[model samples]
Target: MSQELIQAVMVLTKQKGFAPEVIFESLEAALLQAYRKEPHSNPDAYVELNRETGAYKVMAKKQVVETVEFPETEISLLDARKIDKRYEIGDIVEADVTPANFGRSAAHTAKQMLIQRLKEAERSVVYEEYYSREGDIITGVITRVEGKNVYINLGKTEAILPPTEQIATETYHEGDRIKCYIVEVKKTTKGPQIMISRTHPGLLKRLFELEVPEIFEGVVELKSVAREPGMRSKIAVYSRDENIDPVGAC
Candidate 1:
């Protein structure tokens, strides 16, 4: 265990947006997989991390027995006693075989596995974040228009604005900024698909909800809405209290 490694892991935990425990868990799984890839790797091999020091150990758990029928899982009592005098038959013994300290190939294998786990964790963070903001409005730049699909740049990723959701009257061009409501945020094989809409009725409702504080504060209630989207639309409003004029306030 080195103080340098501990500090490095602490910095990585912040950068990767993972807790200390999560990093340790990922490391343990990676180390175990690395150990299994070795020619002499044992199925009973497991890995553990030193939480405070950031040191990890790959260990094979073997049961101490009078006769070692399975060398991978059982160790002779005499051999176990040589390592530790307290060892007796039926006792479990752990063999410390930390790959980094003992071998090169095993260490490389573990490193590759850890990299993959980190990438997947990053994707999960993005998915959960956008999924929470589904059904909300975001302003993005039109990156491209191909056939009936419009691609919008949402900073972190691109969202698709299908033809049905585009405004018929509005002219779209590259780099044009537009406000679109997020109809859905879906996780697909290609990654997150943020479906945005310019013509959905919810867009108008959301706009009013944002602009008019009375609807948000319960001072006025929105009864119903009828829309010819991006053109003609009518929204009915009612005052919760007779003293306040809903239509005038909107």
Candidate 2:
């Protein structure tokens, strides 16, 4: 079972691109929750997992006192000395209390919890990745058209091209490759909601930056752009070097 758990972690790490420590921490938290659900469980208990061996143990913390008042949270100095002679009354002792049947009972619950944690991690990753790309141009394939919204597959995630952001004269269809400017990226319960646009003037500026080397290299500055979506567009440009003609360079 330990080997199987380690194997699953390795597989998920490779497939999901998650750090091993993240998965281990999540699994330990899940197991801790499962252990706490058991009858007469110690409230101060924590699960310690061996990353290399995939072995785990449930440990409960008890403070050493001259007299034991709460058996669950306090241990007599004499008892603490029995475990370790250097133990003092003010010290805390952590004892192993892993149940014999804990592995079997907690496996299912831990697996479910780990899956939920990974999904949340994935959403966070996607949100951060897309958030940094806001205001940039991205190319994607149109996957589907639902009502007035066009869904584009951008490899890692999907983007939405709503009616308000679409070109009025242009029609969208599935399997068509298109480029759109990312207007906004919002974190939602479902995932990152990426709002893209085909009619935005930023799209024209981005296209110019991509196709025009002078604009991209800062030799010619693209001051502003005015667009009519599928109709026509105009741009204002200037160059710092008098030798370079900004209009011709573009």
Candidate 3:
């Protein structure tokens, strides 16, 4: 890699919220793909970066042999000795054979591999970030409507608020702002999927938690919640602090 390439990679890593090590790992996999394109290129290659210079190198392993059966796996002792004098049969030798550009086709392969790895990394990040938010309330903007289901944009992810999960009296339109409870979070091939509900009992509890400080502070406790999605719900509450009025708090 050159200075220009390193700078470009750094910019992309920061912009895409990817770690440098991840980008470099993807680069290593990309280089292996580039090697696959060139038969002379070593498959058993180790990619390393210069600590001081910030340059990349491709290393190869060559095994010494008396009579070479597999040309790629074994190298004659005579040829091995030319690279290193202490070469012995079955001994593996490491060689440097880094290529420049690796041709347009190889570069394209590397780009595609990097993109695929980056997408997987992004999905993992989204899943880890949202998984813990189950049962919590999230504010979202309605983005689309497909039949009875509404898709809401919640910053990092789009949540599906199904018809069965919607409140009975409330109506939504595109760009309408709404709050929903995160009923579940699932990992799919596309990305992290957040299933939200407007009529879940958890939604009312969470809304109360947001509206009343006593519940949030643990002075008032919500004992039970039951709901008929899209209709009405029931909640039972108790207060550890006798001085606190649970109903008044709500």
Candidate 4:
């Protein structure tokens, strides 16, 4: 790889929030797979990346033996000594099996592989982030409406608000700012699929924490919540201190 390409890769990985070591691992795995797919590739092939020079090599790691029984994994001592005189019978040698001008097709394939891996990494990150926020409230904008189902954009990922989970009196439309409780988060092949609900009792409890300063500051302890969705709701609260009134604060 050239210095310019290496710099571009570094910038893109940073932008994508990928660590350098993970990027290197992904590239190395991609290179090894590419090497194996070539017509004259060895089965015991490996990939080597020069971090300082931005140069990479795809070669076979073979053990030097007196008689070559498995040519792919073991090389003749005479043949190994031709490349390096110090190669002994039990020594291991790296024989360069890199193709001529691999930068053309192989480079394109490597870029594609990196992008695919990066997307998977991003999805995993989103899943972990939202998974921890389960039973918590999230603010999102209604982006799409499909009859009974609605999709809300929550910055990094979109969440599904089914009709069953929606408030009975709420008529959601595009661009509506809505607060929902994250009921569930699933890891799907396309991406992270989140199930959000506006009618859940947890949503009302979370809304109280946000709206009431006493609850947020831990002065008031919220005991329980019961809601009939869009109609009526009941909450039980108590103050930890003598002077604070939790019922009046809400």
Provide C-alpha RMSD values for all models, in order. Answer: 3.2, 1.9, 3.2, 2.8
Which candidate ranks first by TM-score, i.e. highest? 2
lDDT by candidate, in order shown:
0.80, 0.91, 0.80, 0.85
On a 0 to 100 scale, what is the lDDT of residue 130 in model 4? Answer: 97
Which tens-of-lDDT digit does each residue in 106-157 have in candidate 4? 7778877877887888899899999999999999999999989999999888
What tens-digit string does per-residue lDDT give for candidate 3 at 88-162? Answer: 998997766666655445567777887888889888988887798898988999999999889999987788888
The total number of steric clashes, by the backbone 3 Å criterion, in model 2 comes to 0
The predicted structure with the larger lDDT, 1 or 3, is: 1
Worst 10 residues of 2 by lDDT: 67-76
**What is residue 75's positional error in candidate 3, in angstroms?**
5.1
Q: What's model 3's lDDT at 176?
A: 95
What lDDT tens digits, residue by residue, belong to model 1 across residues 95-157? 765544444565677678877886777667677878898878889999998988889898767
Supply candidate 2's per-residue lDDT for 147. 97
- Score candidate 1 by lDDT: 0.80
lDDT of 2 by residue, 78-180 (tens): 9888889999978989877677799999999888888888899988988898899898999999999999999999878998899999989998999999999
Clashes of each: 0, 0, 0, 0
Clashing pairs in 3: none
Model 3: residues >4 Å from true position, as ranges? 1-4, 37-43, 49-55, 64-71, 74-91, 98-105, 228-232
